[model samples]
Target: MLLKKNEIVEIEITGMTAEGSGVGRVEGIAVFVPGAAAGDRLKVRILKTAKTYAFGKIEEILEPSPERIESDCPCSEQCGGCAFRHITYAEELRAKENRVRDAIERIGGLQNPDIHPIVGAEHADGYRNKAQIPIGQDKQGNLIAGFYANHSHRIVQCDCCALQPKPFEQALDAFLEWARKSGESAYDETTHKGKLRHLYLRMAEGTGEVMVCMVVNGNGLKGEDSLAALLRERVDGLKSVLINSNREDTNVVLGRRFRTVWGQDFLTDRMCGLQFRISPLSFYQVNHAQAQRLYALAGEYAGLTGKETVLDLYCGTGTIGLSMAGRAGRVIGVEAVAQAVENARENAALNNIENAEFLCMDAAEAAQLLVQRGEHPDVVVLDPPRKGCAPELIRTVADMAPSRIVYVSCDPATLARDLKLFRELGYAAGLITPVDLFPRTKHVETVVCLSRKNPDDRIEIDLDLDELDITSAESKATYEEIKDYILKNYNLKVSSLYISQVKRKLGLEVGTNYNLPKSENTQVPQCPPEKETAITEALKHFSMVPFK
Candidate 1:
């Protein structure tokens, strides 16, 4: 059946995507329904339809799933921040754990990946330590401030957000009050005019300190002292208030110049028993409690002794490295951002840590330079961004021949891709832990331990296939495994013939006289391009080798 716009149809939700959208099937076409729970029988009206899939809006919940919950946020429907607000917390954890597992097995090509249980947050609500609320104006030209709608710049007026602390609410209210009183013009993204663009807020969970930075179009805001007083009155433990001028016509939030109008330029915060001075450019973990949990797990995986040197890559403000300084003999941190490197050094000095050092350099370049300097680190820790570590960086780290590698990643897909590279470089990732640092959101943090495989761990074997009378190329993965991989990942079913054909095309020895048509006029359905690509990727994932 062809799905049309405004067509009402009943569909049963079978699964969910990583973006927190429930996936259902109508006449075999997958329909993505937002605000839907897994196992829901929903009456959905098709909003838009594509060739293979369609987007639908829930007309009515005919049957709710066990994972479904009553959303407490009034703006949950518009603001896509709290992705899993409609689902139970337990279910959300389940989905995240499954997501990591799927990434490792399907994407990382690791069979039977040892993934531990997700570390759930104790307080799901009010967990965000950082908030960037966009400032806007209503259609009537009234001052409005809130989060943007899903995939849109339209500000949805929200009095409060469940993900932010109560203090953030007070600070936002105070800012709005000041904005109205000062007649501050809300910035327009389309026009790129007006003064106030955004209200950036940060908190120190350990020290109970807060920093409020107003992102504006110009260098200054009118009546800065008055705005600071208003925020300080409502927000408890207010430490700093500053203005960040972002005059460019880009969607990027922060600008090039930052000037302190009131208070200190940076805010001091404590994490893992170490104090850190957080500037506007410093890359600090937004989720404070869950971040501690993640760092602890990464430290455990590092398995550092008191006498071994540890290298922390992408060391933002030296949080992880400083936390492990007391355990290791010496901690060396490397970061590309200059300001973050300065913060890292400051954090080390603030904690009276004399054995740790921070270097400002790219992760790949730093590893190469350290090799040239004849410095060997016992353990290497990586906490790369969403794009993950560079391939050359992984190779350089492997060249250093560290005993262990602890990797912390925000994107599972990239992490898995890098893990595959590590396997090729003689390093093997063992147990992986996925932590729900961003609860009620689709994003999850993962930490994996990759150890240098010892010679004793491998059993040397030389096989003579001719002696066994087998005249076929041996594949690392079986046909059934490849078929299952394609089915689960792309939701497409493939036959053994297609897999063999793809392997043969790649110069792999498929076997003598295998998958050959008996007659010249035999009608064999060729594998489509999509299925062939999937099969080829599956072959690569399984470590299949081509005939030399």
Candidate 2:
């Protein structure tokens, strides 16, 4: 074996992974070392090893990269909350830009894609407007409150985090004091017992309004009034204090039941020159300033001309749609969460935005409804969850025939996959801009713009069939034969709809009557790599170009 557990070795960090780990190679084997940056020489201790790669931790730094810097937080390494704390902000932005570019070229199969430089955060520290901290007890049976240590559930005691505002520290101190004085035990995940579960704090960056919420095992707490009074007195700009009851034994933090102990149950914040009511259960970006930048970039990609209609899918609380409402003739926002839809309507009314409307439905269902109503939008914006958009939904959006698609994604791999599908649907991927919303972490947000490909851009080929060596029977492959080959070789069943789509993209002539009727419903599964390759070969066998 080349390596063993607890083995120490010296390696030079050459690159970084998408998960913010420094990568080094020994005998062509990759070693991932956390808390290490590129261009750094360090002594590392191997913790685990596999056939092709190994995992290790930095033991000592013999030399540091020029991008490396001294972290201000003492618990940064132990807390695992911030991955780029030891590196400069410039390096973080560059790494994020490279990550986005690599995903598009390597995963999406795009060659030399146009990826702009990353938009760096104006303030790297104290930029987070929301904080969810776990409450636990130390080995001495004393109360401790902080974030989890790395991947483990052990809480690393922290009085303050650099990512949160100054008011959060004061609120933490008050909560800790109140919990200890009231003799409330912190919830233990292993035994599934105790009262206090977590402390959730949110701040409105533009308005400076603060909200304090407590997650507990029960509905109410003893001395709740005193705790509220203490927080209001200690934390400035306090607007709301609420309690969330999570009686279940699951890892999920917030429960459905919420009780207002003091003030209102929601907080209001302004984004993109509009006011939005934020509830505890509502989905909002943690970084307020960077979100503004992100929305502005989306608006630029939409290229609204004041006479065009825009459709936003998975529009959380209608932030992006509302931001572009002024420029577009009309904006329609669709969200699955009922409460979020209500909040979106309320926000529209609050801002007096007359051109925006929100509906409570899933993206696919809403797209189908719009198509049934014969509504066509000039631009479509998609902001989906980490799993990304479903292939069916992508097809539905393409059916809308929107001239432009602005996709806002948090996961790069999923974005690349979806972009590939969009490419096959006659859209040309352009200008992908990565935004550093979460500076110290591995997470990155990207805004990609895809324009409908012009008919003139299609490739034209002239060939002499008489000089071809292959026979007519060998050169022709039926669609059914192609499907069977894919299934037999890859063990993946593909839908006729998907095959038709691919054939159409490859410039193959599908008969006018080849499409299924509207009444025929079927499930089209995602195409895996092996299946995609087989399908491409089938297209090639029939003398068609599989890709541009």
Candidate 3:
């Protein structure tokens, strides 16, 4: 049927697009409806009709899919923060995994590739580590702190959000009161005026320390001391307070104007048992618990030995590199962000970790320096940003020829491309694990492990072993049985099992943090019902490989 603009058409959603659009097809033409997802039969009014595609707004969900959930946020459809809030948690994970796989298959030109299931978040809600709220006043003249609307720069007041902790909302309220008492005016986007512009809040996971930055338009603070004191008293977890004055007309970020007025300039947090100090603009994982798991997977893929030295390229605040420092002899983290480097140093000092170091430099430059210094790292872990690593850095890593290369990426297409390049340079792609650090969003984090290629290492053997009575077993049996047990239970090949068993025996526990109890007999905790099936599906697809 030929659909016209403003025509009401009911279509079954088949998939989700990267820009958070729900996709359907009608009469062999692609129809995209906003706020629609797979399995949903929605009644949408066509907004625009193009030659090959049509855009529509969902009038009603004629028949909601089983995978749909009642969104907890009041402004779910309007707020741009959560793109998948209407979809069930399981469906969200599936969509994200599919997005990565599809991107890899389509963009990277990889077919029939073994892709691991995505490791999901244990606590989906209140998992965000940072929250940025724009200071705006509604038409009725009430100050609001939340996010912008879907397609507009105008801020929408979000009272209850599933992503942020309860304290954040309270802190927002407290900040508003403080602003009123201080006579601070909210920034007006239309007129380009006002004193207060934005409130950036970041909380440390393990320490619960908070850093709040107030972006202002002018230098003179009318009630700086009083407002700071009030925030410290009212906000229970606040550790750092900063005022960043942006006097320029352009919308550039506040980088240098930050002045610390309270406890510390940065806050500390732990991921994969490694400590890090996060400054105002430092890049840390928004979801803390999931990050621990994500980092652990990266370390495991790196296959680090106690004697191995690691180069953590694009290591923002040294989160991944610092976490793996206990296992690696020395960790050199290089990031382009200077503030992040300072935070990384503070984090190392706070944790009393001496073997880790951080430097502020471009990743490609750092890699080149390593080459110039005649230093080759045994393991090279690259956790580049969404833009991915530069071609030069990739080439440098290939030339250096590390024993193991761990590539942690937020984008899968880039990761697959890098892995393909590494494969061309005599490195075999080992294990690729997808992690869902952000629930109810299209974003997915991936960890890819690559090992140096050796033509002579071709013997393949299974290491599965049944549970044995360690008390009665001899020394040889204990070792052999334990190795086989890990292989059998974990379903890995001999070499992989051997390395994992050795790490465990040597008390080097690496990988994502599972909140296992301190008690020896405690069982692994269970995920929420909505997320369990997705995790099980992911685990089924998870496997190790040996490339010849």
Candidate 4:
């Protein structure tokens, strides 16, 4: 049962990988087939083989899976944009949820991750609010616009993708018409001699405002006016047309320089009951409606109270931080992008959120800066990029001693890795929620709630006592009870700090400010011999410890 190249074999797909590849076993050897649906029995041609696994291509469908569907997009196989287009949405969600579960349990080493069922979007069609289609030309020099092939820079021409809104299709069509007449050559990556490189698009799902930005190699488009006029005529609610100049040869889609050729330079979108201005490079979620649900869940897991200071790292346009500003006493947002930080500050002002402030700095630097400024955040919200937060940043934030950490991640593997690190640093994560913000694609969003472990290794849950039926009372003897027991039984008084220091000496977790001095000038008195003897006797009297 060794899998060889071009060898055809029949197998039944039983599961899917996180990358949306169907997995089937042949004599105990796993074959990974892309564009395959689970429960499908198919004849697969082995393309590549390894020691324990192999790569395959679907040769013939012996029996189609019950979850299979006819793909609406013609280029769904070639384009890497959507992986689940050929499968039913329900089945797709199952795969994504399983992916999260596997990552948290298998990779994260958590026995009970407490994973909730994934929250699927209401509808999958045309949910993307933004798109960046690379610009290319056919052999006949006809301009083409579509996504790049999977794992390659070669363009796969798709006039209308199902994931994008109608405005994108209209704008793309208009660009092709104008560029065909104006003779603007597509950027050749090899020679780097052309002007047009990528067609960037953003739409305000709430306001229905559309923005079209042409990413180019040189200064600007030669016939930008005609292009703008054509876009305005074809695309409804055309709000802006601009150019991003990236003269250097790089893989980055948007450039540093931007110039508006028509209309305004930005588009505004509404999310979580707040207005946000979206620039070309703003880190806004692509799915607008689903984003509201995602943010609401993140906020709920954060468990913010009015007396707590909240820190939001990688606060893209301050969306999550601004949403929780009302519930939190003070909100501080930190981001690396200057433009996004500007938008975040403006968003706060636009929403009249006086309690929130935004800073433009890297997350690790901002965390250290906040620590230096004596800002103690009770809750910290982290929404990092796909690569997840750096280990140093996680340690710095944990050092801030936030009571709760809400981690929203796009990559499950990295999220699991970070959660393991947090556990080692005394934060235990529970109740991870997977969200399908990007339907019909392999991408899934997950939010995990981690709480600092107490002395008994129990999580400190911030909630109403009646709601949770739980209190912050220690399991063992209360500090006041211990003090009274010593004073009454042995006729000696003891301070709570001294008792806490004893607990620390016995390897118990001493909470914040228990036995530590307030400042450098503050002196703490040590427990006298008589007080220590009385405390040890009280410990036995109260059945707290067995002492001779």
Alpha-carbon RMSD of each model: 14.0, 11.2, 15.7, 9.8
Q: Which of candidates 1 and 3 is the stronger one according to TM-score?
A: 1
lDDT (C-alpha) at residue 151 in model 3? 73
Candidate 1 lDDT, 1-548, residue by residue in tens? 77999999999998888888999898889999999989999999999998889999999999999889999999998999888999999999998898888988898899998888989999999989999999998989999989989998899999799999888898999999999989779888888889999999998888888889999999898899898888878899888888999999988999878887767778888777778898888899999889899989988998877988999999989999999999999999999889999999988888899999999999999998777554679999999999998899998898677889999999899999999999877788898999998999889999999997644432112122223322244535667777788878766666666766787788777655454444554444456677788888787777785323
Off by over 4 Å in 2: 456-548
Which whole-number lDDT from 0 to 100 does residue 14 have in model 4? 94
Find the number of clashing residue pairs for candidate 3. 5
lDDT of 4 at 7: 96
Ranking of candidates on TM-score, top first: 4, 2, 1, 3
Candidate 2 lDDT tens digits, 1-548: 47888989889999888988899987777999988999999999999999899999999999999999998899999988888888998998888888898888899999999998899988998989899999999999999999998888889999899999988999999999999999889998988889999999999888889999999998789999999999999998899999999999988989888899999887899898889998887788999999999999999999998999999999978999999999999999999988889998999999999999998998999998887554679999999999999999998898667889999999999999999998887678998999999989889999999997654442112123223333334347655676677666555444454555565665655544443333323222344344456677767755665343
Candidate 3 residue-wise lDDT at 444: 85
309-354 in candidate 3: lDDT tens per residue?
Answer: 9999988888888888888999999999998898888878888889
Residue pairs with colliding backbones in model 3 are 117-538, 293-512, 296-511, 296-512, 465-484
Q: Would you list the C-alpha lDDT of every candidate in the order shown? A: 0.86, 0.85, 0.74, 0.86
Q: What is the C-alpha RMSD, rounded to one decimal, of candidate 4?
A: 9.8
